[model samples]
Target: MVFKESFWTLSFDGAAAGGKGGTEIVLTRKSGEKLYLSYKLDFHCSNNEAEYEALIWGLIAAEKHSIKKIQIQGDSKLIVKQVSRQFVLKEPVLATYRTTIQRLLDKFQKFEIEHVPHSDNKFSDAFTTLGVRVDIPEEEVTIVIKKRTEPSIILENKDLPKDLREKILE
Candidate 1:
């Protein structure tokens, strides 16, 4: 069978705070397009469960998008190794997760999972920092849950004529 030349990149990260947890999935296409999804876990779960949920959801999304080749990355070493079949799963819950992930893996023409350091996975890290509240000095807690198509710093400001700018603004 001829393999496709295109591939998509997938990354996942999970965060837990005050008995609450969430997962983030970021998918990047070869054309520099990206899709980000973040969900807050309603039930109680450890960090590992959240990570697996992220991976599973990400894979499902790839299937929906008809992606045939994928390179998966995650900060969770155990989940990555287990999914890659490089490490044995000891926990029953994680074993179940692995089974689900394996079933999804069959849908792809080619796929690989790698363990990456948290520092190198800054985009996923940023998603985990969502839904967090930080106190600014003595003021109220500021909730930060940013979901943007482009990074705020890199956004381009097009200089349109005054008339056009006024019409667009209106």
Candidate 2:
């Protein structure tokens, strides 16, 4: 089936356990083609951090695909609200995440993000759960496994002062 115009749907979910985490991103084109990406975080982070990470990566993927319009769905209400400016951000780290997301959002001509029930977001959630639990494989799989050594925000903003960078890394 074809959409009226070029549009895409992006869904993301994140799972973290015992200082490790994983993020799953599903990008679907208007033509019904889907791309799945999963990432293993090598750094320690909270579940919220993982959610932000998933979102950042998902946007990056969509930008790479040259998508101009997108519909974003996630189960994290906090992340969605924070990104939408409905919630006040209290954490510095997440503030950084929000900033990064804002910058990425500017690349798209149109985009909308909404919170969905966990059950409604099961596909991405299930993939994220599996990504967090499974060990990295030696061979290739249908979904290529990627490793994130640090937060994407940190990686993107290298010009920050050393002290602030250290604090954010902590």
Candidate 3:
């Protein structure tokens, strides 16, 4: 089944600070209805890793909604370039992230990712920063707040090589 009218605009940002990380996602439907999601990372990760997590979770939400076409915007140039294949991924963990993102992209009928400046991505960035600094109750805010215990890729790939799995799970 395909959703012909289900085109969406997705924007995401992630931040890691003081051994904690968080991600925020904004999903805008073609009708202009918006959904906000904020995730607190339970484990330590780099800023780049957190960025990838935001993108991954956004894609998952789009898929759940059966969105066939999407436009994705992010402030992480490295992540956007790597996912678009304009840049090479050197780190093993990042390679895994790219691979997982590619798999998710394939599920969509059409998708495009573009790099945006931080100033242009302030909404997600600001929420993500707040999400990292304090724990907000879902009932207290309109944004949906959730926690991620581990990387989505790690949970999906059970057959991963032992060494790679260990490194990513670290």
Candidate 4:
């Protein structure tokens, strides 16, 4: 069940004016033994909506990069609830975004959305606060990879050149 080569993290953040709240998002995937993908977007929208959009855009980016398995990390509890099927879609505003996310889920071999407290998502918060956006999305995200593993056979599989598998045999 090793997915991701190294660790590719994707982060998206957003903010809203007047009454809306800001949002921050992060998605991480591993590329063999290196990390190549991480994104952060800060913009304005309803708090819930912004959260949804962050997740949406993050998935779009991951798909664009051809990521097969993704573990989505977020700071909003409500967003995680909705995405993980724990809460029902009561608000109509989320319907569209939920649809978009559902489609993305179909593209990955494994997808799991986890909820972390805002404290745990400090980096993502800082990213969104650094001038959040309302209409446009930011593409400035930091992606770092550790030393490449020469014997990363899991990543060598032709079908999985982009495959990132991490495992610890007991």
> Please, what is the whole-model Cα lDDT of each candidate in the order they appear?
0.70, 0.86, 0.85, 0.55
**Comparison by TM-score, 2 against 3, better one:** 2
Best-matching candidate per lDDT? 2
Candidate 3 lDDT tens digits, 1-170: 98456569999999999877999999998788998888888788889999999999899888887888999999999999999999998878898889899998999999989999998987778899988998655456443777766776784587887787655433
* Candidate 2, residue 22: lDDT: 94
- Minimal lDDT window, size 10, model 4: 144-153
Query: Which regions of candidate 4 deviate over 4 angstroms?
Result: 1-12, 19-44, 133-170
lDDT of model 3 at residue 77?
Answer: 97
Overall local distance difference test of candidate 1:
0.70
On TM-score, who's better, 3 or 4? 3
Question: How close to the true structure is residue 112 of candidate 4, measured as C-alpha lDDT?
Answer: 70
- TM-score against native, each model: 0.73, 0.86, 0.85, 0.62
**Residue-level lDDT tens digits of model 1 in 1-170:** 99556889999887666655666888899889988776555455667877887787678778878899999999989889888888888888677677778887899999988999988988787767563222123233222222222111111124556675334222
Q: Which of candidates 2 and 4 is the stronger one according to lDDT?
A: 2
Greater TM-score among 1 and 4 belongs to 1
How many pairs collide in each candidate, listed in order?
0, 0, 0, 25
| Candidate 3 TM-score over all chains jointly | 0.85
Q: Which is superior by lDDT, 1 or 4?
A: 1
Q: By TM-score, how accurate is candidate 1?
A: 0.73
Clashing pairs in 3: none
lDDT of 2 by residue, 60-98 (tens): 889878899999999999999999999999888798999
